[model samples]
Target: MIGMAMRGEADIAIGPITRTAARLNVVDFLTPFQEEGIGFVMKKIDSPLLEQMFHVFRPISLVCWVAVVVSTVLTGIILTILAKLSPSAEHKEASLSRNLWIALSSILGQEDCPRPTFHQGYIILGFWWIFITLIMALYASSLAAFLTVPLPNAPLRNLEELASQTHYKPLVTQGTNLFHLFKSAKGGLHKRIWEMMSDMPKITVMDEAFSLVETGKYAFISDSSELRFELRNKCDELEIAQDSFLLTQLSFVVQKNFPFKDAFDHQ
Candidate 1:
């Protein structure tokens, strides 16, 4: 790590470092830029309503809805025809038909008359059917749009990475050294990659130095700091590499309150 630092090629790095070894010989690790806190947060439990909605026979609910829609459409058509053809005389016809049956009691005791028109009833029912159908369509379209949009996973995997790009992807907790480190060093930082890191395993930023080594299958370490503001929730997940780096000091990039001529000063 010290040999690489001498060349000044590693533009960006975030990790723990003391003024020792090859770094002390020539390269500058700066003051501690950030400290790392590490731990794992398990996945959230699924909602009960959502879980039950996907259970077997759920399609039955959809089928019932479709059936109701079909029935309403048919009823609307029937009502439309009835409303266009019904007459005010239909009520009188029904009354006369009943009286005729009474007069024919000695004979067949029945009367012939057209059925009463239900035009007004049909018109009202049809209007309601159209309203319900429109609502259903709007709901379906909204659901489709929600399903189509893509949601991004959190960036920045662990504290070391958090130390470097933490300004962009790191999450911090109150009173954490990592939080203070980021607060100070965020103004200006450097970066670089190494050949050894290419084969390093992946690690989640659970705590200090978990990402220092690598597993056969994975090659990243994860970390986060200053969680309350926004980053902790955003960079909830991340992957980090196992390459060790020269830790830089957390220096403040004073923009508004630049006491010195340079923005990068001891914050």
Candidate 2:
């Protein structure tokens, strides 16, 4: 379209062509109709059944659980030793199994759990109760969060995340402004991404790229609004990632000396 307009085959080249410095030298752009930035579309993935089943334990780590178990056993052992060392005859007949049962029941908030027999035992039990209460409170809060928070639509939320991952290939429409943006990148994330996609197959059409995205293998980058418009009907299977970059105005192209520039800009 740009070439046609430049050659006088068309008076105006229309659509959401990005206004860039290089293009400006060859053709003039009407006042931008819209301003948008780059974004990506990818397929939505559901949490696996295995992940859903084990979500109950997501609140706490394995190491923390192990530590809790070790603490409970140690508390039980200390309580049994204290009972045997007590001066009172009534408190002297302590067993490890009984102490362990008491510790477990107390930690579980059991009302009928046996109490410590001596002063030292009571002090230790009090501290243990405090520790167990804290652990339980933390676990409850974390479990609530795990249950209520929805999973992300896609794992790659933004450009940085997409750049960091290796499994998903980034794609752009060939010969587009976005394509040029990466091709001309000299340094930073854009340059890195361009390098990464150097050997990957090129995508020439948005629909073709989106189809690949649906397979969970490719990410298509384009103007944010355009990506949204294209995915409006397919939202159940595809979604725009939470990224906006390469900000630019979109306008129609006209010949460099086109006479009606003001008339078009006003609309």
Candidate 3:
């Protein structure tokens, strides 16, 4: 409609179009009738506590978890190789799988692992014991702290938090102003959000965005007023994020330098 208006095919483009500096270059906007901002809409969490039960692994970060696993495997391989080379009569031959199991069990504080007889074996076992004990202590303390403390079940508060988590796939309609905002973004939260949405099929309609949000695994970003009006019937199931972004005025688009612009502004 904006192109049509610019080509002299239409005098004006109607509806709740956003007024932007870029759009003003090719067309003119009427006196903005309304002001609004972008918002995120998602299903409300009904049982935050139950949702948290599955997040037991949150006590350790992904990097730390990967480091622990890699170190444990490397320790097991070293122990197995040392066992093969040790000439002591007391050093029993063990398979790589057995040593791996021993390494895993020892980290868990199990008592069945046999004591090593050779000096190198003893040294390796000693260091491994100390390392595993420290890791266990840290994990135990953190888990205990998490269990005993009361934490707020805060809803998705802002874009930074939303972009950082994998729980919800944030979505925006294709070709809309909000979509273009992220698509053209070079860095930071907007870029992150665009990358996330790129994985799913392009969403073309607002209804599809609402359907995806209903499943609780996706969030839709759109005009706050539109979301409120559309989701009015499903207040209990869906909610808009408390915060908004990309605040702008909404107005109708008219041909560039339309003669009636002054008269339209008067009303």
Candidate 4:
């Protein structure tokens, strides 16, 4: 499933039809240069799932309570443990007298002692925890990048030009299923100079939306509708047609033999 391209088991498709993404393999899909909006549809029903998840965040405030409890317990524990930390020799050399000396030192005298080695061990453990977390985070990030397919180049003009160009490479999204109209635009060429000209070279493909523009030097094309909407939202220099045949649309259709088109219609 992954790396089918590396394995050399991929298939390329050419059609005068709408192309779906070839998500599983590497190849060319000669698809119609049509524009369409995509959407997600689901049954409508009210449910408590969204609300229940919101309540899960309520316990996040417990971090403050945990901090207070841990700090207070740590303060008391450290003070009690300070007695044992005085010196091992103090236990055999003297008993409560050393305690009295410590109390006196705290009140008016002074006590000199080396730092605790356990604190150093705690610092070392913290660093070890941070290092493991960083490694795991880096591994997950790398895996995500590895699994992702790069965006395919959009052929601003037509399909064949985008697929064949090397120096003027066009980037397309991964698995761009193109149609047959792009691969076979030559059958009726004498009267269609504009369509023929669109098949010219130097149209390197890229998937980024903003890569095409600057009308004089660069020409961008998509489904006429998409081009219209994109220019409306994008820069002023991008132009569209007033009376061009390049305008198009996409419709859902079933095969002539597929009787389910009538029997299994959308509600």
**TM-score against truth, every candidate:** 0.29, 0.81, 0.59, 0.26
Residues 54-129, candidate 3, lDDT per residue (tens digit)? 6787777779889889988997788778888888724354467767877788887789766566677778878988
Error of 2 at 19 (Å): 0.3
RMSD of each: 17.2, 3.2, 11.0, 21.4
**What is the lDDT, from 0 to 100, of the residue 14 in candidate 4?**
22
lDDT (C-alpha) at residue 258 in model 1:
22
lDDT of each: 0.37, 0.86, 0.83, 0.36
Off by over 4 Å in 3: 48-154
Candidate 4: where is the Cα deviation over 4 Å?
1-179, 187-210, 214-216, 246-249, 253-259, 263-267
Better of 1 and 3 by lDDT: 3
Q: What lDDT score goes with residue 139 in model 1? A: 56
lDDT of 1: 0.37
Q: Predictions ranked by lDDT, top down?
A: 2, 3, 1, 4
**Candidate 3, clashing residue pairs?**
none
lDDT of 1 at 196: 22
Q: Best candidate per TM-score, number?
A: 2
TM-score, candidate number 2: 0.81
Clashes of each: 44, 0, 0, 28
TM-score of 3: 0.59
Predicted candidate 1 versus true structure: per-residue lDDT over 79-124, tens digit per residue: 4444445664344433433323322221221235222346564355
Q: How far does residue 247 in candidate 4 sit from its true spot (Å)?
A: 6.0
* Local accuracy of candidate 4 as per-residue lDDT tens digits, 6-112: 24343222222243333313332222345453211111122367865664333335674465345434433443355355453233223334333333333222446
